[model samples]
Target: MTISAAFSNALSGLTASGRASGVISDNIANALTPGYAKRSLELTSNATAGQGVRVLGVVRRTDPVLTDNRRSAEAMSLNADNLARFHADFGALIGPSDNPGSLTNRVAELEASLITAASNPSAPSRLDATVNAASDLAQSIRSAGTGLRDLRTRADRTIGQQIDNLNGTLQDIEALNARIRRVQLSGADTASLLDQRQQLVDQVNTIIPVKIAARDHSGIALYSEGGAILLDGSAATLSFTTAASAEPHMTQANGLLSGLEINGMAIRTEGGASPIRGGTLAANFQIRDELAVEAQQNLDALARDLIDRFADPAVDPTLAAADPGLFTDAGAAFLPADEVGLSNRLELNAAVDPSQGGNSWRLRDGLNAAGPGAQGDAALLKAMSAALTDPRALASGNLGTGVMTAGGAATAMLSITSQASAETEQRASFAAATFTEFQRIEQEIGVDTDAELQSLMQIEQAYAANARVLEVVGTLMDTLLRI
Candidate 1:
């Protein structure tokens, strides 16, 4: 080759090597960075002019299929994680059936107290103990109901926060899309912009399951899996209304609960038909509207069963036909329509509850009797004990339509709690396993520092070779001119 031509080739080679080294350094530096894609310098051989190399641009190494799979896996993992946490929290509130302070254990204590009171109907201390046990049982149900409502309220608040975050992310993605298009049109490096966009997309995926579509001018459009447009040329708006507090009677069917809205359209927040399933937001809604609500209903049913058991006319004939029984709905007969909040409103009958200034001797007499009956009359106490152990149908649909004793009803409620706890543990284990697998796959596709270092070594050799060629060319030119 001519000296001039040799000089031109050496210069091109040196420039290409320098660019490659820079790209390699970037890869090594971002090896541990989340969402960072490894980059490589694209080069082409210039055969026409015999130039050593021509830099095309930087290419970001990524597997579109793997990335899509990871996004989907992450969404599912988050959904499971939220659900598991809800179940665990609920279980902690109710405690295990065998625990001394559990609902069933409290019921058992009351039943045992009633038997002891029946054996010594004239003993004021025994009667007082029975009343205390009954009060304790009522308070346990009320506390559990309150705890469940609080969980629902918190879930509602979290849903609102997630909606706000989702809206913000969508807006950011829309702005990034415009910038990316402008950079592409100007023929400038869009790698940084693309990275930012990917990070935003990942955030969006954690909130809700979405489908991404390529748009013109290097832009992307986001849509819900159910076909709601989240973003196109502009970001779509999302909104939610949060309730100050949740109550057992407040439900979606009654329009007392909040639901999600997207771009002025209402959307289902739960079930298979829900538009935002397979994400953390969906899990929160399901906990609030479905799981927590169901638990509250079960507790209310247990309370209703307890009230009804003592309220039976046969158990307390001394009470007027319309008088409140041993256990009443806030000092009155429980109306079937009021079963929704029975747990929260359950209270011991004032006639037997000393805290309500009633006589303890009333346990042996009729609740409505003007004064204490025979001191040794054990008829009412025996009947009350039998009433507690009597087999009867429970009001809870969750426990199925089966006849069971008071203790059996408590056992059924505990069974429900145990089942939920077990399911939560299983789901958590599965989610952890899924997340670990996805992380492994992601790591496989991430930057390899060792590979980048080896590439840098190769680039250094090429740069040194090119520099030597230039040095030799310079010496030849000097020699020629000197001659």
Candidate 2:
């Protein structure tokens, strides 16, 4: 071969080695970055084309099938985790009165006072203690209601932040798509641009799964799982907005980024879906709606049950027709607004006042056939205690059948909370196992140290051989000139 030809071939070999080295450097740099796919230089022999060689592009190492499966499993695991947290928080609110100023303990204290009062029908000191117990129970209910409302408010704020993040990520993805298309059209090296774009796509996946499509110029287009196009070409972009109805919406239009839009879709809904998933957005939405709101409703229901049952003469004969309930419904019908539930109509009746009605007024369970006026006060108290312990009585619509005495709401809350705690722990364990398995499978298909090292050795030897050829060519050229 001519000296020039030999020199050129050697130069090409050096270039190929450099490219391989760059790929190896990149793989090592991002070894720890989550969702980072490895890449390799795609080289083609130039001997066939009557040229030195050509670098096709930097191709990312990935398995689309494995990625999709991992994402799906993550969604289910996250759902379980969120449900468990909801129950845990609710459980905290539902347990015994001894929990550092918990309402359940306060209610129990009041019940003890009432029992004491019953023992000495005419003792003024006993009556006063009974009144104090009732007042304390009312305070406990108010605090619990406030705590639940606070949780709801925090959830709302988190939802707003997640929506903002989703918008930002979509904009970035659209912009990257435009850059990639432009590079491809200009016949420039678009390998790095593609890498950046893929990284963006991976980020979007964490927020929600996306469907990617091929573009005409070897470019890519992204779409939501729902078939709404997120990107088209250089002329089209998807935009998202919070509509007047405050619902999340997405739309596609003109310009690199003007078309695609997403409006008010929370991380998840009742039927289990949202435009976004996988990452923190899904977690936040679950807390806001399902966990926080549902717990609030459960507490509200319990409160209403307490108030309506205690205010009736059948449950507390000392409570006259005009008197308000013992614990007072401090909550509005759908009220998280005021952060408290109370009955405006609850008050002990003065006519058959426990202090003055010959100390004859009694507390009765709903099952007693005798009217409040006829049942002995002692029989009513026993029935109320029995009702508080029975879940069936609580589930039944008959508040009179089981007057949830002081501490009853606390007991019910504890039960709900315990169930939730178990669920949360179980879900977390499952998620951990799933994540570990996914990583194990991915490592098998991912970068292999032994393979890359062996390839590196071969590339280096080829580079050295090519350098020797260049050196010989230079020596020959000098000798011929001397001759």
Candidate 3:
């Protein structure tokens, strides 16, 4: 080749080697960066005559199929994790079956107190103890109800926060899309912009399950798994009105609770059956609307059973047909429609409450008797004890349609809690295993430091050889000019 042509080839070789080395260095530097794909320099022969090489563009190493799979797995893992956390919290609130503070233990204590009072109906101390136990039982139900509502409120607040974060992320993605398009049009390197976009996509995936679609000018559009468009040319809006507090009666059916909105349209917030499924937000919705509500209903049912036990006309003949029982609903008779908040409203009958100007001897008499009857009359105390042990059908769908004693009802509630906790834990384990496998696959496709070093060595050699050629060419030109 002529001297000038040789110079041109060597110069091109040096440029290509420099670019390759730079790309290799970038790959090594970002080896541990999350969502960073390794970069490689793409080179091609120049079609023009006598041109040695050309750098076409920068290529990012990635497995789109694996990336999509990982995103899906990550969403599932987060969903299951949220569910497991809420169920575990519920289990803690109810406590273990053997725990002294548990519902069963409280009821058992009340039953034992009744038996003692019945055996010695004239003893004021035993009567006082029996009344105290009954009061404690009512307080326990109220505490459980309050806890369930508080959990629901917490879930509602978290859902609102998640929606806000999701909206912000969508806007960021939209901005990146515009930036990517502009860079592509300017024929500049868009690799960095692509990496930033990938990171944002990963962030959004944890909030809601989405399907990505490539658009024109290197842009992307996102759609929910339920086919709702989350983003297109612009970011879609998400809205949620958070409640300051939650109550058992503040249900969606009564319009006292808030639901999700997507671009001014209502969407389901139920559970797996909801429009947006398989993410942390959906899981929170399920906890707030389904799990917590069911727990409250079961508690209210137990409260209803307790009230019914003391309100039976045969047990207390002085009580009118509509009179409040030994255990009353806010000191009044329980109406079926008021069952929603019965646990929270349950109270000991004022006639038997010492703090309410009532006497302990009244337990042996009647709730509305003219005065304390014969103190040795143990019939009323014995009947109350027997009522607690008698089997009756519960008023809660959570326990299924079945007959059970007060103690049995407590057992059923605990069984429901244990089963739910176990199922959630199992799902979380499976999702964790699946996510780990996907992450491993992604790591395999990530930067290989050894391979990058090897490539760097090759680039160094090429650079050195090109520098030698250029030097030789300059030397030959100097010699020719002297001659």
By lDDT, the best candidate is 3
Candidate ordering by lDDT (highest first): 3, 1, 2
Pairs of colliding residues, candidate 3: none
What is the C-alpha lDDT profile of model 1 across 318-337, one tens digit per residue? 76666678777877888888
For residues 1-483, could you state the per-residue lDDT of candidate 2 as single tens digits? Answer: 766777777888789888988787777677666666778888887866465767877787878778766765555465556556656665565444357456567656756665766565455566556655655555555555566555555544555554466567667766777777788778776656666766666666555556777776656676656444555553222233322221111111122112113442222222334544444445645655455545554555555555555555665554456555444432112222322222222223232235534232333322212433433345555434433343434432222345454355556666566766896779777986886687678767777767777887888898889888888988999999999
lDDT-better candidate, 1 vs 3: 3
- Candidate 3: residue 29 lDDT (0-100): 93
TM-scores for all candidates? Answer: 0.95, 0.72, 0.93
lDDT of each: 0.85, 0.56, 0.88
Model 3 residue 260 CA deviation in Å: 2.3
- lDDT per residue (tens digit) for residues 1-483 in model 3: 899888989999999999999999999999988889989888888777547898888998888889989999999999999888888887777777788888888899999999999999999999999989998889888888878888999999999999999999999999999999998999999888899999998988898888999899989999888778899999999998899998889977688888889999999877556768988888998888888888888889889999998898888888888998889999899998889979988899988989888877778888888987787899999888888999988765467677888888888888898899999999999998999999998988899899889989988999999999999999999999999
Which residue segments of model 3 deviate by more than 4 Å?
Answer: 271-273, 355-357
